[model samples]
Target chain A: MTIDALEQRLTDLAFDRPDAGRVTARVLSLARKRRRRAVARLGALAAATLLIAAAVVYFVPAADAVLADTPIAGDLLRSAGLTGAGNRVTAVGAVASSSGFRLQLVGAYADSTRTVLLLRANPAILPLGPPSLDPQLSDQFGRTYHVQSELTDSRTGQVIIEFEALAWPDALTGARIALKVTTLKRACASAPFCTDPVSSEPMVRGSWTLRATVGVDESTPLALPAPAHLGPATFNFTSVRSSLATIGIEMSVKGATFDDLQQRVADGRKGTPVFTIDLFAPNGDTATASYSLGEDQRGPLIQFLGYRFGPGNYRLHISYRGSDVDRLLTVP
Target chain B: MEAALTLSDAATAALTPDELCRRYAPSVCRFAGMIAGSSSDADDLAQDALLRAVRAIHSYDPSKGSPEAWLWRIVVNAGRDSARRRERTRWIVERLAFTAPRESESVEAAVLARLRDADLHAQLRLLPHRDKTLLALRYGVGLDTAEVGAAVGLSTDSTGKAIRRALARLRARLEVTRP
Candidate 1:
């Protein structure tokens, strides 16, 4: 069956008119304390289910076997500042580390922190569209993340964030991030929806450029190709704390394309941006650097990251710059 | 001084609460019914929705369409809020037991009915829930810009912009899915 037809069928499932009943005393009763009680019961049930599952996992040998019992297995993910509530057996989130002096470290450079978060899928959830050859499935990862890039009042220090799940628990593997833009259209002025280039909407006109990057110890900074419009928008970042390790991530707009800007982005050549961030370990050895695109359009940029960390407190950071055809990289 | 039954109703034509409730009740009930599953919850949802409509009535713009469509908007918004709560509760449970309401019969019914009430509702649901609600009220419920703004708790101008954006998405989805 065609997808449009499939969508129609799915949409129809929610079309029933269930409220044929009159508001008699009985109906009122149903609306009364009953709904509140039902909702409360649902909440309680959710709590009870979680507690019981935790109990089972605690007592079952299989749980231990699947988790941390094996050599080079689940043990001391704690050292990398890793922890998890349950096996979450199947997960897809990326544990990112940054150079934020929030942990114990005998590391190389940049303050360091390591953190892991979990995200999962809702069985009823539907993707806005079909998956592509390299579809960005951030939502399905064991944890979902939110991204934000902020230029401090100083206009120098960028506090870019790769937010993990509300209560994520894991360790750093690499700095994973994603970006997407869709539903671009031209507004017809005369008719408000004229698709003709002559009549497309001005509001929808002009190409958009976006960029992000991370640098060590608040060192790297981007050379803005053009001026930017700043605002009071707050960047909220969520994370689940694990070991004493700390990880930091930073993002910023580097630049945009002018002619057919939207077209370039859709073509996937708006230039796959890069991340320049430093990684640190607790020990004084093995400090490293990483980027989003190793060289060119090599692979899927979603959560594909590089890393370096050692014993002790770890912190890391990512910095980037992107604009139309002009791509620039820097570290403060 | 006697209040005159003789007084022209228009001068004091504001509808009695009961009259207002009666007039818009069925559409609200229908909307809630489709959204909440069981006509039972729909009945309750409709009443609760009306109560909210009354409290927020001053915010309504007469320049918009008639009050009936506005009431349907209220019922839809109320039902959605209730569904989100239900989903969240289900989420907590699934996390613990690894079982969820999305697996249940009634929940499935609720999702289907809630999203397919009108041609536009079905179309919007295929896009995203946020887009669905935004468009269903603007076009399916046939609210004017001002009314749509009030219904969505957005500014009148913003409501139009939102509907436009949603329409763009709908077109894109259609284009991609075209055989």
Candidate 2:
């Protein structure tokens, strides 16, 4: 059949129309439950924090020393600065073995915006090189989360996989999460330069599923200033979500058409705008932008990871084409 | 409440979650069904996309594009994710030598079976995921090239070229499958 004929047939196909009211009710119900859970979790965390503080005075030193010895934990401590971030990290100790490989879900550090899962594979799978891991994550609510990026530490054979929820039910606190990995194929022959695996490479073809309960972390939303003017664009700082692990900034840019934004994205695969955002901690430490999560007409949502900002004010400096503006932000 | 009010602008105030679902859920479901090849999968995909849109409604800016384009982008991502999950499950089943029954006979499969165009349906199914998505957006959802490009994060020219290429591939596959 011709393409036009196929298109016509597709348009005429008998597709079932779902009940809009039912769908909307279901969506709203889930959203409400998630919001309620988040609020309740925050309250409980506050109470728990008081109790944990007394307990941590006795146990934190030993715990820190032990974590400092491990390669993955040391890296996490340096990168995310998750030390003593109350209940932000969970120790999952679930293990599954398949096809001569033992995989352990060591633990996870989660905030409002993302979850970083620490997994260790026995037999040192990464000593030779990096491998492509096909992992699928789903929670008790049947909400699936996508893996944004994966970092492997060859020294400990541990994998750090970061997940971002692109839909509702983003709250993972106290929810049962199952992570299933079906295949692990060697993607590269070398350590740093990992390319696609050739067909001849050996592939591990079995399933390893680990389940864990995610701990809660504080995600505080900061009050943003009014829209700022940058040449040819009006940048409205819509929202700023801060947590120990990451800070997410959402803005809407006016006076720039969607085509203009798309062209800028085309010019740079990073898709970041022609501007820079810098976060300066109270201790003179700085955290750089982690990723630019794609921009649309609504503007770009950027994430800054790593650098622990204690309960103090931070300076957010923005620069666009030689013009600079700074805003002081408070982190509770 | 105050934070919500501060976040509200002309773009977000224009459409609430209730209005969005009431107006666009049907079309979203239809588009999802076409891409997922099953009504049941479509239901799940549509719900996921709508809930995502609702939670993220504060980020929607009308000046960026039409609400339809914004929502369709969510739908497209949801569909792609579902497809990846299905592929993984299929891979596991094949590896285990397990004969898992089909989730359900998809609407497209049923219609093609009735019309004795099962070969054409099979050919369509064999197309790459990206090609199928483009075809579904352009033909199944009746989106123009520009709308499809907006949803998929491509330039209009790129979207048009991709759709034409997908059509050509489908035609070639159908020819090969014919007796």
Candidate 3:
């Protein structure tokens, strides 16, 4: 048969279309259940945090001295290792209100490899669950960035969203940043086990825009180790930069093009021969490569969140086609 | 109100839950049915995908593509996850000495009942999973090469080449099977 004929046949395959009204009702009903569950979980977490805070206050007085004015922001910055030197902080205090809610861009923190925006909501627009902010960000150089990770304090409606700056390492310094957010969603508590939002909880719609200029932080590049080989691929580690939120690794892969590697990764998801890279911390904890920014003549840049990787030696593990290689590396 | 909004219109406008269900539910159902190879499973897949889209709507940047493309990407990923889950279940069932029903067997039976091309359907099942997905997106869902690329995370040229290669492979297999 001709391929076109086969296509036509496939298109003609018969199946009964689901009833839209029934599916809608069922989805909305399930969404309500999910929202209620999220709220309950949030309540339990808040109670747990309060108890921990009380105990910490009573037992450890030194912790209070290190906390920023906003405890949530303080904790986030501290965990990200952004409170130390080589980090630049700018106070914007830009505010906007709409749809019965108020939003403020409190400030921004920039390091050599990442930019983090701190935002606060008055009257707590998001439900007592995980908050989802979809803000479109663009810099003066017209380069856009996506949110790499976000942490929200539901009780205070305080949020810290991070973006990778490795693509244009020098462009963020002293650049005007515009952020526009039109809707706020109550995101799923966790991925893969996620559920729909409550039908009653429509996405909060409003236009909130803020502008700020990022300060300069000198980029500090770490020394790279020797190339690691696996099967037919030679991985040359070109550059590694550590920031508060993530460690960016730029490497070139010889003997495999970007598309080939991407296809291999996709096939790996299907129980086939896999290709993966992982970074292990000194404490034996590990973080897998999260996402790729893009590729240039050098190679694709991969990033791993610096959550588990404190100041110590790390082990870089590469697995491909049943072959495994581990090499010791240090992140300064 | 549901009938008044086109898919593109829904993309630029604020998407309500009602609007989302009305504008895209049937298409999503059909697409999910193709991926799942079973109508019953397709309903569940469509529901899961829609639920995810609603919750992750904030991540949808219009500059990336149309809302339809964004939603279909979610559908494709959801289908892949479902397939992996089924594979795991099948592995467990086999270990326990239970006869697991093949997804293709259901597809063959359904095609025999609905269309006059059961042989072709059988051959299609023999193709790799990615090839089947590419075909389903391009032919079954009526997505163009660009939309297929957007959904599957490939460039337009790469998508076109992949689809052509998949078609050639399917044709060779069909010829070998034919009298």
Candidate 4:
């Protein structure tokens, strides 16, 4: 028989349709359960934040100082547990080593907002200069956790990489961290003052993975009440939070549709972000925020993970496409 | 409720989960049953797909794809999972029936003509899982090349070639069995 005959035969195969009302109810019920779980997770996160704030305020005036003073790797090895506020700090680390490099999961201590991983490479075998890695960390359900920043020490042959844990699923207290080293080149080529030969050899590639359990440290959120109207959309910054590794903005929008924000971009209106929340430190360094809209939008949430924010007051500049938004506020 | 009144199935990306299930459940169930090789599991697979779609609604940007295509992708994933579960069960049952004559042989004897006329169905069962899914979505569910490609994670050009190859392969199989 011909393809038409085959198509007709396949189409003739009968299957009894399920009850629409029952299936609809099941789907809605599942969606409701998912939302409830999310709210519960948010409640837990808020409680955790309050606990961290209390500990920071009452237990340690020099908490930031104490944590920052310890070597980045050392602090990861010995950070306080979340059993109680102001509990004695103890060292708990998740370490994974591969043939080429050793990875250490330091607590998210430099600031509580960012999770840090320390990579120690053999300097002799592969000269550690400016090496880049493709980092993939996911929960059991295949949701991705993103990295925010990478800091390297050429002298120590150690790289401290930080990732954003704000968007990670609640069920996953621990995540699978997969790091694929894309390039490991000689230091001479990348160092500021270099007279050594520039080697044209292919860069070294290696991979390592670890299951990183999140510790109970958190950064205090500062409310930044700045609202700006752009085109058909209104951008609102509800709060700002910082940790050792990341700076985040809780952003919401009003008076916008999928066509105006996402569809035009998908239809090739240029690479314009629906919302661009930029963080500017006092030192003039700035990091742009990135966001992902879940299928249901309760407004938009923009977070800048992996952007290194040190101890200082800062300003946040909000913009839409290329135009400036009116409500620029000093970050609390 | 206002949006429900205004938008067509092809127009709006923001169709409610209830609407989606009501509109597409029949075809989705048929597609699932074809891929699953049993109609008994089709309802369960369709329910699973709808559940997954509703849970992931936040990530569904209409700008990237149509809602129907998105639902098809979920149906394919759910159907594959169902097939795997059934395979495991069948394997266990086969091992347990080592002492008994195969009941499947007797069942086939009763439905011999139906199987022969439904040569496409028998031939589809013998194809690779991916090819079977591609064909099921195309001919069984009446999806176009682009929709089939979207559901199966293939490009339109590749999908076209794959359907042609699958049709040729099925034709060859039917020819080989013809008396």
Candidate 5:
């Protein structure tokens, strides 16, 4: 018989084993045990991880939303609750740990923002001392301030969440406090552009302000003049695939030409002279469909990998350092 | 949609691990029975393949295509890995021998041969490792040209044309002494 015929006969023969069911069960049991062991091993490894030790941080819950968890300290807060702010916080802290613990809470309107007041009247019980600088408190501004903060010092102030920090002392002056809220960034979880996986490389992932416009238009071919810093700067491409979504881009520094950008990715991760990417919408503005790139290879011949974001109209802006073509891209 | 099976077949699919053995245990044994001396390796590989399928069921999107094709891919790859590992541990020095066996010692001489043909294995070993792999992916595991390209890092256009040339060569060699 032919080899194909013989193979078919063998497949048929496989179905004839009277004891096959009994055998498969034993194999399955063994597999289950193996998987369980793997899961337990992984769980043990995760428990040993130290990085997550103090990451309980989130955007400071909005003052409007903070009442759910705040304590009803200080009589001033109680009076506000009586008048209507549900839970009143005349002070942001309290006094006493364990022994002889008595909390005296008072609130009085002073600053524009309502405040939490906690007084450990029993000095023996150890009231919270003066507001000292919490060196660990970061001054980084996020996209939104869900301020989970307590201004222990009367001089507390918030700004418009700017790129630069407004001086603490500058924010406080007598009866008024300024919210120097500069635009800090918190990448929206549901933000249309947040599909990029969170990675720990110092290179920022999600989104950034573009120095120029870049995207697609109905008639014009993407006419990005070569970036000024084109010589041999490096760049990256990162993407993911699941469901039906697909996205990909090749970023390179300016002046190197499109051929140069393509060649860089073709040579893999190590091909250098840095570059960056910008995507624009139909109206010549940054679109929600943007992300950073990463490499999936080790050596010079590594494959160029990127996410496949289904189907849509898109354009790209290439940025390279120290060159005329650096920001030469303009959106249609 | 769940596949509706006959009473016996339905029972087989739904069978408990122990019952699954009672029903289809022989299929694995027979499948394993060919290349192996005893049923142990067959049982082991078959069990492993099935277990993997069961565990990966949650992640298996049926929309991709046939589950059987997917399962078989895993099975064949597993088998190849096992073979390579065993090759290492045993370290059998199979010195290259180009000559064919005498024509007189035909299929007539070995009716109960475990394998389909010894010549097939010998000629397969003669191929470069990459070609051998292409053969396994194309025929043994039954991947289409596009799928094979993805696995072997070849473009689809190249894989199909290359596989055709490679397979034709092997088929011709096998048919040389045939009627």
Candidate 6:
């Protein structure tokens, strides 16, 4: 039997549809009963109990990396001045301390258009569950770098964040940058499987002011052939921008109007464009690159893979629903 | 006080419990029914799921998932809870009975009977609860990848990949059992 046949059989099992009206009535009745029960319980408790517990203060020594963990990439360590001869520190206020938690900026590495911040958080207060890291970097010139991705390893409490600095100036010799963090608590001893793991309450919040000097590694942009027209917009292959951690496509969108799209976006009515671009390796293996709206807010934004591809031929496929365009690119 | 009441009423009117039930009760019931196996159990489970969802609505964060996805998750969990509590669950028996045809079965039942057997049924039955719920929610209740992912605690990419893998395994098994 074919896969479609199996799917058909699976779908057919639900043919005898349950009664919506009956179910709804029963649900409403049950809900009303539960609400009444909850209210009655609350009323009974109001008349009976008073309990308080003394707050206790706990302290744990901060975990610091004396020698850079070799598990960290060499390029990252060097860029942050954590490694190499005549190590110059570019990180502003490298360590941020807060109630029951301390986050250290282990290193900061920048390429042509992106920056990666490797941070370690020590949740010394409560038993650590999964933790989330929110890192915000802004320069004195009122330019804020967009955090492209924030990846956290719960086991080690290490966070690797990649932010786009494409819109920043050519040189960041002595720019004062502020980094703010809002850490969320994911797991506690109780209710780990609850619907809202990281709710409104943050585990800890801290901000640091720092002076940063980015040593840029200039990357040559690759030229591409003429634009490929797909649906309403004309897709132009502009350049291949390579950073320390990612390989990306820099392209523009034109011909199709984004006036209405911009309006919807401004009104918070629309997000995440319908189009997607994927990169496929020569051997039929596919790797999907996370994309974001262009820094310039123009067309053909950034479609970048987290890591650089090995020396090989790859196909960049631009697709909208079913229709697509393929471009062969060779990584030198 | 009147203004506050009016605002509260307007908010309640926006997504009333009755409105939510009307919009999603059928799918919820169908999802429960598919997992529960019998009509009576499905009906009871659907009510229980909806009630649980409503009670937890105050805590429902839209940032986490859509309401429908959240409701389906409850149904899936409730179905599993029932299964664990009952030694010989009706759904387990129904799953085995579904494949083998009885005397003078209906036309649809006969069609299914021709396609499935005890061996194939056993393989399908042996699948993990999450896999079964994934298939049921995607096909039986007609939830999209994102919705199914939200319901089953998987990302969209993972959900799509899982469905493909499960389908491939089932197809391969069916091919092996083909007469």
Root-mean-square deviation of every model: 27.2, 23.4, 22.8, 21.8, 23.2, 22.4
Against the true two-chain complex, what DockQ does each candidate achieve? Answer: 0.11, 0.14, 0.10, 0.13, 0.14, 0.20
Per residue, candidate 2 scores C-alpha lDDT tens digits across A1-332 of 34555566555666454566767776665455322111112224324433443244233322211112353566544444454354567888899989866778888877766777887765334311123454888888788777655555433456667676423444534567899888763322222322222345546778889999875565778888545444455556778777766666666766555454333223445344446556666664665434343566555544444344466766665544322344556766
Rank all candidate structures by their TM-score, best first, as comma-separated numbers.
Answer: 2, 3, 6, 4, 1, 5
- Give me the runs in candidate 6 sitting further than 4 Å from their true place: A1-70, A73-93, A124-134, A140-142, A166-178, A182-202, A206-213, A231-233, A254-274, A281-288, A293-306, B1-179
How far residue A7's Cα lies from its native spot in candidate 6, in Å, is: 53
Interface RMSD of 6: 16.3
Steric overlap count per candidate? 69, 1, 0, 13, 82, 2
**What is the C-alpha lDDT profile of model 3 across B1-179, one tens digit per residue?**
21222345554577766667777777777676566644545555677777667656667676667888888898788777656545543555434532222323333334334444556655554555577678878877789999999999999999999997877666655544444
Better of 3 and 4 by TM-score: 3
Off by over 4 Å in 5: A1-19, A31-332, B1-29, B90-92, B96-179
Q: Residues A35-149, candidate 4, lDDT per residue (tens digit)?
A: 2111112234334433443343334332222113224444322221111122212233555555444555443332344445555443311222221334665545566555554
What local lDDT score does residue B30 receive in model 5, on the 0 to 100 scale?
A: 46
| Residue-level lDDT tens digits of model 5 in A139-193 | 2232211221222211111101101112233224222222221121121212122
RMSD of 2: 23.4
Model 6: clashing residue pairs?
A92-A210, A253-A299
Cα deviation in Å at residue B118, candidate 4?
6.0
For TM-score, candidate 1 versus 5, the one ahead is 1
Give me the runs in candidate 4 sitting further than 4 Å from their true place.
A15-22, A33-332, B1-13, B84-123, B172-179
| lDDT (C-alpha) at residue B119 in model 2 | 47
What residue runs in model 2 are displaced by over 4 Å at the alpha carbon? A1-71, A80-87, A125-133, A166-173, A186-202, A258-273, A293-307, B1-179
What is the per-residue lDDT of model 2 for residues B1-179, given as tens digits with 9 covering 90 to 100?
Answer: 01121122343555656667777777776666656645545556677777767777777665677777887898888777667646654555434532222222243333333443344544555566688789878876788999999999999999998887877666554443445
